[model samples]
Target: MAGDASPAVAALSEAELLSRIFPRLAVDATHSAATLLGPGDDAAIISAPDARTVISIDTQVQDQDFRLAWPNGYRSTGFDVGWKAAAQNLSDINAMGARATSMVVSLTLPPDTPVTWVEDLADGLTAGIRGLGADGCSVAGGDLGRGREISVTVAVLGTLDGGPPVLRSGAQPGDVLALAGTAGQAAAGLALLESGVPMEQLDDGLRNLTERQRRPVPPLQAGPAARKAGATAMLDVSDGLLRDGRRMALASHVAMDLDPDRLGPLAAGVEPAARLLGRNAMEWVLSGGEDHGLLATFPPDIQLPPGFTAIGSIQALGIDEGPRVTIAGRAADTGGWDHFAD
Candidate 1:
C-alpha cells in the first residue's frame, strides 16, 4: 500500500492566508451586488432584478487546456489560472451581449498546495473580471478541495441591461459579414513560445503574437455594440473563423462567403510567425481559436461601429443544403477547430 508522507502542513487561519497571499495577486473590486456576504460567507447572493440573466460556465483541465509545467519548466502562476477561469466565463457573457455582474468559482487542488497560490488565483480572477469591465463582479464564493490533478470550474452571471440578446439565427441573405477585433494573434503567440524561439529574434508582428497568447484581449463591448447596431446575427470567434462562420450560416439558413482580400491585413500579421514555424499563416488565421473576436452579419447598407470591418456576405441557399463557408470562392477542407480531429 502507498503511504502519504508529506511535510507537516501549517494550517493557517483564513485571515492569515489572505494577508500572506493577496499582495502577489491582482485585485478586482466589486460593486454592491458582489458584496452581499462576501469572502467570509458560506455562499454569496446578488440582486438580479433586470428580469433576465445571462449565465455561462466553463471547466478547464490541467494538461488539456494548458500545461502546469511548460517545455521550459515554467509553472503557471496562480494568477494565470485565475485569470483564465474568469476570462473564459466572462467571454461567454460578452457573447450574449450582457454586462457581467457576479461570479463564483470552484477549485480542486492537490493537498500540497501553498496558501499563497489560492490567494493569487483569487486575485487573478478578480483582475480578469476587471479587465473585461465587469465592475460589479467579484470572486464571491468558491470551494477548496483536494485532487491529484488541478481543475477549475467557474460560473458567471450577467445582466442584459435592457439591451436585446443577439442570437446566431437572424442573419439574412445579402447581409454583410464583419469582424470586430483582430484574429490569429493568439495562435501565432502559442507557436512562438512553444517552439523555443526567443521573442527578440522575431519582428513586431510576431512579438504581438506572444502577447496575444499570454493575455487574450476579448472585445466585451463589441457584442453589445453589434446588437445595438441592429446586427442580424452574431457570435464571438471562440472557435476558428471558419467553424464559427459556418455555425451562423446553419442557424440563419444562409451561405457565407469570405473575401480573402478583406482578411489580407490580418493574414499579413500572422506570416512572420508562420514562416518561423514553417506553416501557413492563412491556416492559423482561418482556424485558430481563443481570439474571441466578434463575427456579425448586417444589412449591406447599414453603418457599422468602430472596431468593425467588413469581411464577407451572407446568401440565400437551398433548405436541404449544408451550411457553406467558402474562402475566396473555394471550399475549405478544414473549417475550424473540432475536438475529435486527428
Candidate 2:
C-alpha cells in the first residue's frame, strides 16, 4: 500500500491522477448559485442572473510566466501556481465590476511532475477562491494533458448584479484617479524572489513580500464598491501602474497626473526590500505588475469607496500629445512587464 502512492505523475494513469485531484478542488460552498451543472459533464452550465455574462481567460506557462525554482532556492509550490491562476482570472472579473460565479481550469503538465504537487495545486485553487472572499464562486470543471512544461489556463464567469460595467474608456478629464490595495508589493516580492539572497536569510517582512508574489491578494470587494460609488473607469493593475494608467488614459483620451503624496506611502511600504537590493521602491510602484490592485477613476462629487485612496487626477490631453501618465506634470519613469520586449 505504501508503494502504491508513487511520487511522480508518470507512474499514475490519467484517471487515477484525476481521482486524486477532483476531491481537492471542491469548494466549501453549500450551494453555488451560478453553477447549475458542475463537473462530470460535457460542459458547465453557469447561470447569468443579470441576463449577461462577463467572461475572462488567462494563461500561465512555466519557465516563462513562472519558474519551479528561483535563484534564491525558493521553490514555486503547486499551491502558489494554483492560487495565482485563480487570482489573475478573478481579478479580471472584479475589474469589470462583477462578481465571479464559476471558473474552468485546464492544466498541461510534464511527465516528471509530482502527483502531490498537482494535488496541492487543486487545494490552492479552492483556497484562493475561498480565501479571497469569492466564496460563492464554483470550480465548474477543467481538463488536463501532457506537455513540455507546466501551463495553467483559467476561464472565469461573472455577473454584474444588474449594474453596468465600469470600463477603461469612461474616465473624464475631471475624474479623480484612485487605487485599491497596495502597489509595488508583488513586484518587490518578485525582486526578492529573483535576488541572490537565500530564502532562509530573509526577515519576516521580506518573506511576506515573497508570499505576495506567490499568492496575490486581489481587492475583489473593492471593485463592486467602486462601481457603486460611481467609478468612471477601472482595471486591475496587473501590468504596472504607469503602463496600465497609460492604457486607461489612451482609452479615455485623457492624461493621468499622479500625486506624489499619495504614491509615497506605497513606495515606503516596499522601501526596505528595495534598499536591500539597491533599487528604488518608487520605480516598482510605477512598473510593478501582478499585485492585482485596482486602478480606478471616480467622479469628484462622490465619496471614495472604503478601500480606495486618491492617487491622481485625470486631465485633458495637450494638443499632439498622446495619452501619457505623469507625476506632478512631469514624465514618469517607464518600465513594466512586456512579455515580448527586448
Candidate 3:
C-alpha cells in the first residue's frame, strides 16, 4: 500500500495510521463506565444493565452529507462531522428511550486525507458523547478503510435500564404531543449556507445558525425522561416535524393535530433568517429536518417531563379520514429529506 503513495493515507501502513490516531480518540481516561472493555481487542464488551440492548447506525458521506470546503458549500470541519455523526446515532438510541452505552465507528477515507483531520474527528466524537451527560457512554471500537470518498458510519449501543422501549405505535387518542428541543434552526442554517452568504458577512446569530447546521446538538436527556414520565409514543425528529409526525400518527393509527400557537416560539429563532431569505420561518419549523429533538405523546393527565413543551394532541382517526397529521386544522406539507427523491 505504501507503494501507492499518491494519497496521504497510503503514505503509511494501516498499522501506522492506527497508532497515530487511536490516542486522539481519547478512549483511555475519560472512558464510559458502561464500557467493560474498549479498543485494541478483537471485539468490545459493553454493559447492558437492563439485559437488553438498543442499537442504531447512521452514515455520512462526503459531498452528499457535507463538504470540507467553503461558503459555496458546507464548510464543515472534522470536528463537526464527528459531532453530527455521533449526535445522529445517539438521537436514535434516545428515541428508543434508552441511555447510550457505547459506539463503534467505521471510517472510509480517501488516501489523501490528513492524519490531523482524523485526529480532530476523534476529538469531536468524544466531545459529542461527553456532551450528552452520559459519562457511561464511550466509543468502544471501530474500523478504518480506504475509499474514493470520505464516509463515516457509526453503530451505537444503548440500554433501556429495565424500562420498556418506547415505540411510535403506542400513541392513543387524547394524548398530548410534546417537544423537548429547538427546531428549524438546522434548516434555517442550511438555507443561509446555500444562500451564498459569506461566513465573514454573517452576524453572531447567523453564525450560530450555521454552526447548528454543521453540528446539531440534540436533547439527548429528554428521551429517557419522557419514557420515565410514561410517554405513550415517541420518536426523534430527524426529518421535519410534519413528516415524522405523520409517520408516528400512521404507526399509531391516529391523527396528530398541531397547534400553530404552540409552534410560534420554536419559529421565532429563525425569523430573521427567514426574512433575509424571503422564506417563512414557520415552514422551516414545521418542515425542517436534522434537529433530532425528541417528539413524544403522553396521556393528557400525565405531567410532562422537564424541558418538554406541549405542542399538539392525538385524536382518533375518523372512519372517513386515514391516519394523518395536521397543523392549525389543515393538512401539513409532507415534504422533507428524501435521499432518493429528485
Name the runs in model 3 displaced over 4 angstroms. Answer: 1-7, 27-30, 70-74
Q: Global CA lDDT of candidate 2, please?
A: 0.91
Candidate number with the higher TM-score (1 or 3): 3
What would the per-residue lDDT of candidate 1 be over residues 1-342, giving only the tens digit for each residue?
Answer: 013232211465545555554353324344435445555577777656677778888886677666665553346667777777877777778777777777777777665666656766777776777776677776666665668777889988888788888888998999999998878887777777677665567677776676576557778788777877888898888778998888898898888999999999988988887887898888888988778788998898899977789999898887677778888768875556666685
**Candidate 3 TM-score to native:** 0.95
How do the residues 143-200 of candidate 3 rate in per-residue lDDT, one tens digit apiece?
Answer: 9999998999999999999999999999999999999888899999888888877877
TM-score of 2: 0.97
Q: Candidate 2: misplaced stretches above 4 Å?
A: 1-6
User: 2 or 3, which is superior by TM-score?
Assistant: 2
Ranking by TM-score: 2, 3, 1
The lDDT leader among the candidates is: 2
Q: What are the per-model C-alpha RMSD values against the true structure?
A: 3.9, 2.2, 2.7
Rank by lDDT (best first): 2, 3, 1
In angstroms, how far off is 8's CA in candidate 3? 2.3
Task: Residues 15-127, candidate 2: write the lDDT tens digits.
Answer: 89989998887766553767888888889999998799999999999988788889899989899999999999999999999999999999999888889889989989989
Model 1 lDDT, full chain set: 0.75
Question: Against the hidden reference, what TM-scores do the models get?
Answer: 0.87, 0.97, 0.95
Worst 10 residues of 1 by lDDT: 1-10
Clashing pairs for predicted structure model 2, backbone only: none
